[model samples]
Target: MECWDAAVSSLSLALMVLAVAYLLRQTRTPTRYGRYVPADIRCCSARLGWLVQEVPSFLLPLMLLLLTEPDTEQPGRTRRGTGRKLLVWTFMLHYFHRGRPVPLIIVLSAAIFCSINGFLQGHHLLHCAQFKDTWLTDARLAAGFLVFVLGLTINIHSDHILRSLRKPGETVYRIPHGGMFEFVSGANFFGEIIEWCGYAVAVWSLPAFAFFFFTVCSIGPRAYQHHRDYQQRFEDYPRSRKALIPFIL
Candidate 1:
């Protein structure tokens, strides 16, 4: 378990570094589906792609959570089974609603990546993480939970806003207004960033921290790319709004 944890942590850190490099290059990658889909790649139905990619996130954790037993005697393990269970459920809950249409390659890659992540997180929490039931009452936990909820709401609402921009047959892009879009160009990305940060704080585990770092590394660059694309595509795009964060880049 220790070896596995160490390997995952190392991989997460390496990915972060690669993400940083990606940001520095500023070359828009084809990973962003929908309006930004690459011209060369043959695409498939978005709904099917979403299911293929995101289902693992929901299922892998659930399976691990049900099958694994906790190690209470481990040095850093929290003694509260309830807290751990709640954390796992919280993690699973987020994945349950995450399906959205995307490119096939993107879905496949994400599915593969998330499968490993789900296993790492679920296995860690169920078998290795040591939290006490009393953790539920901790101020940190409460604050983090609130932040997580807030982020989730923002993420879902932002997606809705984006989706509503297009009518049934319309393919044109429109400026998204209302909600966090009024503040940040990548409101959904920002919300996801906050969500994972809150998760890291609430769980306070190496795996959780790794997951948070990975989220920032992966999504942060995409947000920047989206911001750049929007600015280039629309002459009247808002100049005041930042990319991933409101009023700050």
Candidate 2:
């Protein structure tokens, strides 16, 4: 079991490295989604795509939580109690509820990726990760939880801002203003990145770190592309704003 877990962790790390390489190439050439939606690709409704992609993130974790048994008696395994379970569930909830309109292919690919990630994270947290209830009171966990909550709030708010940008029957893209958009073109992506970083910090596990690494690799480049697109489309786009970072990058 330990060997299997180690293998999975190694595979996750490898995926993260590949994601970084892919991002390097993608930054030069954006994917065909969002503003760059390809004419050739057939896409379904955004809401449907979102549900298809994100539902597994929530469901798989919940299922794993219900099915798995923690290794409380193991010599090296720390007994994570309700606090750790709550943290894991919180992560799952973020994906379960959040929705965004995206291309069919994009959502399909995301669904596949996230399903695997959800299983790995859920399995690890429920059956593999060792945490004590008292760990919740630790400075690292407390700080990380606060950061996670803040990031989740920013992410949801940013999404709301984007959705509210277009009024009824409006299809044209507009400059997103207010909130973190004042500082970054991809405020939602930035918020997500922060959220996962906090998750990694709070969990302090290899799987969590791998998840965070993959999130940065995947979302960071997309944010860069969005920033470029905004700059090209809107001459009045904020010059001070960065891509994914607030005043940096």
| Top candidate, metric TM-score | 2
Work out candidate 1's RMSD over C-alphas.
Answer: 2.7
Regions of model 1 farther than 4 Å from truth: 1-32, 70-80, 98-100
lDDT, candidates in the order shown: 0.77, 0.81
Report the Cα lDDT for residue 29, model 2: 79
> Taking the tens digit of each residue's C-alpha lDDT, what string does model 2 give over 130-173?
76546767899888888888889889999999999998888889
lDDT value for candidate 2? 0.81
> Scored by Cα lDDT, where does model 1 land?
0.77
Worst 10 residues of 2 by lDDT: 70-79
Candidate 1 versus the native: TM-score?
A: 0.87
Instruction: Give the alpha carbon lDDT tens digit for every residue of 1-249 in model 1.
Output: 332667656765765675566465545463566667767766666567767777787788888767665453646436436677788888887875644557677778888877877877777777655565466788998888778888899999999999899889887888899999988889999998889888888888777887888788777877887888899989999999889978878
**Structure candidate 2, residue pairs in collision:** none
